[model samples]
Target: MEEFSVRHRRFVANYFAGKVKELRFQLAIVVAGCDKSLSTFTSGGEVSRDNHQAVLYGFSAFTNVIQTLKDAVKTVTNEQLDWSKIERLRHGSFMRNVRNAATHDGNPVISGWADGRYFVPSKIVRIDGFGKTIEIPAPAEDVRAICLDFAEDFCLLLRETLIAAGGIEHLKGSKFSIEEVEDAFANSTFIPPFAKELFAQNREKIEADLKDLKHDPIADAVKELGEVIQYCDSVKGD
Candidate 1:
């Protein structure tokens, strides 16, 4: 039984590390695509078909990340994660519906429509299928934003669950250490390797554009965990 526990923790640590890397790559794609698509939409230009496809791809990626996090928590703690308790995910049905509509129904296209009262044109990705019509904000930036929030909340929940289930000591033999995990969570930038050159070339403008749109859920998660770890260490020292 002890041997099994050791092997299980090792497997989980390695699996989670790999999954995080993949999810970060997916997030990079989503962020870059959204930036371009949103710029086009905001400038009153029609979003290109390629950009529309990218947004759909991002939706699929975001859905995958949510499922992966839920599975990871269950695997680590042997308890199901209650998605409804997750604030960002509680209202995420629309995103799942959008993914289903995009995959099963016809492709959702970016369309511009005026707000009811304001009459200012805004973009939306709309699709009709599965006995319903689903519309999500254009460029799918909201989807990306919600996914970031969900990931952070899920991490904090998993941390608490792990501590309750016997604490991080149980993961001793695993490749994941508390410090390493904290570092990963602290580095929230999600730029992919292929985009490095492009990002470097436009760093100034991109940074300026994203200044108001910065989201740092991962950093928030790390900060909370750091506080808990500090308290635990202090208690042990006393």
Candidate 2:
């Protein structure tokens, strides 16, 4: 476990906070489309391919964000955070196994729709290498509830972890509000015309982060030295 300064801890906490917001936003888009499909999977209704993709992608991200945050905090000896213990509580074991399978499986692409039919029964079932079919329960309706629950729990855990690590004010700048995003998604039945706003926001944030990263004097000096070395080598060859 590596020790991190308050600054670094805050950075990591804020990073995960943003990720959670992004995940919730995306999940809302999917849930909007799958709302009916989830509550009434047995009923005949057409759930879009994109909607199914959203659920899978969102679920995978939710798992990964939790895992990364817990792992990083576990290394903080001053805080006594334990990764393994976290995974053992509150459906944590189930989440870990699912995340591992989704991340490391040989079949990289898992589908919510097959042969123009949407998956129901609230689970993703597949055959393993030994010819055994593995069923992971993930009902679409349950997915939404689970994600919201996890998000709340994650935020609380992260706040505590950061404070323990001496970050008194970390994660305060996160703009992804779970309740607001949920309400926004809930009020709409379809993917809003402006649902693409999140993508644009992400792009702008990336640009801002790049700008902040460009002020390294040592890196600039190294680049200049490399250019000079290349010029000298070219002249010598001449």
Candidate 3:
């Protein structure tokens, strides 16, 4: 993560957010433990599913979303965003692990419509598996929805990062995640005023981010405020 101007930080963060929402809406919801599902069953009618897929699926959006979020941190921190512990951020652990399970167990798609905010988790459940019942978190409609909304936030984090880092060219087209994005953004020293153009030079980045507004992460840009993102090294050195 390189140091970023205010405007560039916000630009990338918001961009990936939109993509996350659109992708969440597209995932298909299906029940798990059903026969003929993607996960294969065992010869003795006992099947074991690789929950890793669910983990990967859940974070797929987030990881991609974060590619740019690093920029948000760099813009403020003037250093690299720490990817070592990205999964440690609040609400990220349970959700990422949980959604992976859902996807693995055949809960193809999980979504929420309540509270005018929706998020989907990759649904996975263990039924008829060879081992004991896996205690995956019970799917709550609200959690699902918030997950989607949070995904959008990640998009914002991504856009800010990318723009701060001088766009996808710096990322080398690598995919990032929401968790990574927000974590990096959280580490910055210059949080853009939500919905306010914090950096005049970043206007072009903002426009580029806007051009690909497929996720619509910021319901209202003017109202959205940027944060003072700082890096781990910055703080540790402080």
Instruction: State every prediction's TM-score relative to the real structure.
Output: 0.49, 0.48, 0.29
Better of 2 and 3 by lDDT: 2
Give the alpha carbon lDDT tens digit for every residue of 19-109 in model 2: 4445445545434544645544556556655666666675666566666656555433236556565554455545655766677673322
Question: How far out, in Å, is residue 45 in model 3?
Answer: 39
Q: Over 4 Å off in model 1, which ranges? A: 1-6, 43-46, 87-90, 93-144, 174-238
For candidate 1, write residues 150-223 as lDDT tens digits: 44445456556555654334444424434444444455467455565565566566545544443332333334
Clashing pairs in 2: 122-138, 122-139
Residue 81 CA displacement from its true place in model 1, Å: 1.3
Compared with the true structure, all predictions reach lDDT values of 0.50, 0.49, 0.39
lDDT of 2 at 25: 56
lDDT of 1: 0.50
TM-score head-to-head 2 vs 3, winner: 2
Best by TM-score: 1
For model 1, how many clashes?
0
Query: Residue 126 of model 1: what lDDT?
Result: 50
Name the runs in model 3 displaced over 4 angstroms. Answer: 1-91, 103-105, 108-136, 139-144, 166-238
- Candidate 3 lDDT, tens digit per residue, 160-226? 5434543433322213334444444556666665523333445556555544545423322212322
